[model samples]
Target: MMYKSTLSVKKEIALHLLFWVIWVYFTLAVVDANGIHFAEMDLFSSTWCITYVVTFYVNYLFVLPKVFHPFKWIKAIAGLVVIFLFFAALRYFLEQFLTVQLFNVQNYNPGTGILYYIYDNTFYAARPIILSSAFWLIVLLVRLLDYNKYIIEEQKNTEIKFLKAQINPHFVFNTLNNIYSMVHFQSPNALPAIEKLSSIMRFTTYEAPRNFIRLGEELNYIHAYLELEELRHYDKSFVSWETTVQSDNHEIPPYLLSPLVENALKHGSYTAEIPIIIRLSCNDQQLDFEVINRIGNQKKDKLGGIGIDNLKNRLEILYPEKHTLQTTEQEGLFSAHLVIYFQ
Candidate 1:
């Protein structure tokens, strides 16, 4: 794509001019002012000659790629210098045959002798050698750009994999903590909590590893976990969740909503009076997932905890240029808003 884009009308005109300039300059350096070719026309008028364009077209279109590719550094700068030097030598031999035989113009007859052959050929060498050397430099720069793109792509993949791995260990740790709380309290509801834990565990272990899932299925799993949290802290605390969307079962990335809801519960103390709100809404091209909790002044330090930091990293890696995450901490409210562009 870069090759095609760079080679355009302007560049073609420049190459045409450059070719004639090179031809005239090199030829004039060796030939006298009263030479037969010089007598035919001066530089300005000679540029208009029909043979000039044809010579340039054949040289640039055919000879350019042949010499250029041979001179290119497929390896490194040292390789480029070495290859360009070799291709320059090869170019001299090619010029000897091509200028005499390829063009075959009627008026441009030359004496057939070996030393003059080598001299004329060697004289013609500079233009192609310089152009091919320039081409080699371009190839080296392109190679470096391609290498950078490869590294960035690999790094992106690694980060996505890390975000996918993040959720399950968090789920395990939360469930184990719940079980510990149950064992300590000697609560009769522990068995039922264990059952809810099993359902969530089964889904997270199986379904959440996938790239995407049905919104309905994810909502059902979230509902199950929320019910378990309710059962666990019912006598001592309060929590609530609400969800609305344009579609019933649209597909989205798995575990997209889990981290936000989990962070709300993870940070807020069990003794807060008001219910925590985890409201989620989605339209055709946008999703707004917000978590609102009331924290006393002393407990406000929980705002930038491990879970929220992980949440930010996951969003950055996943969306990069699309999603927006903002956290606001005012007098009594700690809230986070996540706006995702689903389109």
Candidate 2:
């Protein structure tokens, strides 16, 4: 904790130094553009530079926070107005005194009226205030951007945790049901079913907790799941799987394809003579997947399924605008197509 705090302090100091260096350079350039020699302008430049620095910190550290709070608007505005007037008057007198006393420069007119003197001083002071306000706005913008980035990172972490929690429970429940059915029938595939379930459980418990996994690894998990489902259905159902993955090196969010496949198997019509078809194609840029199954006479509630809703939520969080998912039912057939674009 101490190390982190020390590092943060160092970073803040470095950033402040960098900003001041740039500010000085810009001020020098502007003075040079006005054909003013450095020796003659040194006092003028230094005075306003210090004035701007003071103004920026005063607004940034104190006034800005109050301004940001909507409930404190009246107090904040009143305070800001008072500060602005005070700084404006202070800058005018400071510059006048430094120029006249330190450099023996004289521009004051003793005969001038108080109102005219005040007006002239206020006009000169406005320049420093304007420059300070510009720097303060930049500081606010940088802080806002940093805050937005932190928020996005926190939201992403929360979404991944939620998805992982949902996936494990749903997957385990479905796989256990399949295993129970196999045991109840006293089928010869019961042992192999247990092995498949074990492998899937391992993947979900370990691999799926990660942010990303190789596409090939995910496909292998899907294969294991399909095999387990096949054992449960026995010879009563048929599945046709096809793939055209151009590379196994591609990475995707873990368990991304499992829910779609699970939904197909759970809701597909088993009595149909036509086999359920699942197709997956991938290239360097994108992945395309489709699952088509025969619909039974009893209409499957596709929209009402928790698995599908969970899948949609995960897709929205992970892929956002980078992927498309569509489901259609026509002529006793239900089809789900998904396309994901890689960055």
Local accuracy of candidate 1 as per-residue lDDT tens digits, 165-194:
766777778877887798789987788889
lDDT of each: 0.64, 0.75
Query: Candidate 2, 302: how far from true, in Å?
Result: 2.5
Question: Could you tell me the lDDT of residue 203 within candidate 2?
Answer: 94
**RMSD over all Cα atoms, model 2:** 4.5
lDDT of 2 by residue, 132-247 (tens): 55655665676667677777777878877887787788888998998998899899999999999999988988898889899999989988988898888776357787989889
